[model samples]
Target: MAAPLDLDQLQTFIAIADTGSFTRAAEEVHRTQSAVSMQMRRLEERIGKQLFEKDGRVNRLSEDGERLLAYARRMLRLNRETIAAFDDRRLEGHVRIGTPDDYADRFLPEIMARFARSNPRVELSVICEPTVNLVEQIRRGTLDLALVTHDDEKGQSEVVRHEPLLWVASSNHAVHEEEVLPLAVGRPTCVWRRAAIDMLDQMERDYRVLFTSWSATVIIASVISGLAVSVLPECALRPGMRVLGESDGFGTLPDCRIGLMRGHTGQPAIVEALARHVSESLDNITLPASEEAGMFDFAAMMAMRPRRHRPNMMPGW
Candidate 1:
């Protein structure tokens, strides 16, 4: 395999190309003239490309040098971004993060894996609960941060992602066609449940609550068993489930606004680290090309992403 390009050498090369003189370029980088010359020699040998050509008494970039200069600047800029991402403190110690049961299943795998890989010494504590309880914990200082369903009426949060709120039913059954629709929904505090009820009421569609739970597993079980239809975000759709659309008289529901709620305490390094990771992961989360497919190619979709490392699956929700 080719050896990795040296960042320091690239820095020096960029300096020489900019200053057009070894002595001044050395002064620009705070290196001795001989040292700068040595670095350039090594850089040329490393790439087998002569980056500088003599022009009168000054140094001018060869065609390869001009091409490499752009790449060098980009690499250094990325290095700065990478360093800035970690908060300015030792990122260690335990951080507590909460999310609803549904979000835990749909998003935590990538969030937890990426955070743990980046900050191995920083311990993580996770809680799976309803968004109401998660919001309360943030206020009470019992949690460092939370991934929540954003509601501006309730409080402030950083909205990170939005997903379509979909009416869903079991693919194998006709439960949705019942004269009085039986519905499995979350506790009243769930924004998704509220949107589902409000839109149904607006359409004057008759419905009855058959089951209520905060657990995604229970809700999905109710859905897959064809006992009742439910509303869910795009990520929560699973195999054996089908979306109910306008053709089925299911009106449009409000989007699920996923937010990051930080605790009242000023941001700490570890907390900020996890918060950034969660936002980036969720932002990367994508919907299927067709919702009707009812299947997410999880592995195939995420395989192309580069991960520094991954431990075992996150501690159970």
Candidate 2:
């Protein structure tokens, strides 16, 4: 019989992929860096496939590793479901949750669906809003839990993930090279907007707010049409966008931390149960470094271009 894939090893693999750093992954798994490294090697041997490759100092998932990710997530979900099914407590209560709109499509559906399946009696009320609004609502006790973005390093809350804030533009846009950067921003309270403006000010770079909206999609659309460049979480980046980095003469932006925030009062059992599910679901979510160029028609953007422009000096958004 083939050697069974160990759950511990798979969990460690997921930690590494989620954080994109072995040291962070080790911290997450409560293991030494060397121990984690050894586990990865052993896992690769058991599977008869190399799982990771070095990207600079970071280990990016290899092609085989990417292929394993889907199966791993499904298997882990099944494991969790089985365990939940055996639990004696059947939780049933209304849990009001809030999240930034950007994450609504990415994680909310799967998380809520899983929770609904396991706790059929529980009622979930999900509200999609900006992080700022969610934070306030959570503080005011209008929300039981919220997924928020903060810059706190001392870990004042339950940190979910650290997403790099990226400057993105149309694939064929060379706006980064222009003297006055045209910025497509969201609401004034948007975290990315604040960070982008602050970074530009600190760098003494000239920038003009060419467009503003409350929607990330609108900002992204403006970017796709080469109207302006905008800052977004790395995971929010799609195929038609280009992510600007150090090589592109862009200043570094702070990492936006996605964390769980709860109301001042103690959480009810059902709320606590939902929070745990949210943590597990989010922990398993690993975003691709950059989507494939062909995923979105590179040709469509090119053909619609009103003017000749140079290729962006960064990877797919």
Best by lDDT: 1
Local accuracy by lDDT, each model: 0.77, 0.75
lDDT of 2 by residue, 256-298 (tens): 6778887764547777778878877775665532544464433
Q: How many clashes does each candidate structure show, in the order listed?
A: 0, 0
Q: Estimate the overall C-alpha local distance difference test score of candidate 1.
A: 0.77
* Candidate 1 least-lDDT 10 residues: 308-317
Q: What is the lDDT of residue 225 in candidate 1?
A: 89
Model 1 segments beyond 4 Å from truth? 1-90, 288-317
Q: Which digits, one per residue and each the tens of the lDDT, describe model 1 over residues 1-317?
A: 99999999898876665555667678889999888888988989998998777655555677898778768866765664466557465466888999987888779998887777667667888999888898889889999999988885775688877677788898899999999999999988778888999998999999999999988899999998899999887778788887787767888777777889999655486787688788667755665456534353334223222221111121111
Model 2 CA lDDT for position 33 = 87
Error of 1 at 222 (Å): 0.6
Where does candidate 2 clash, by residue pair? none
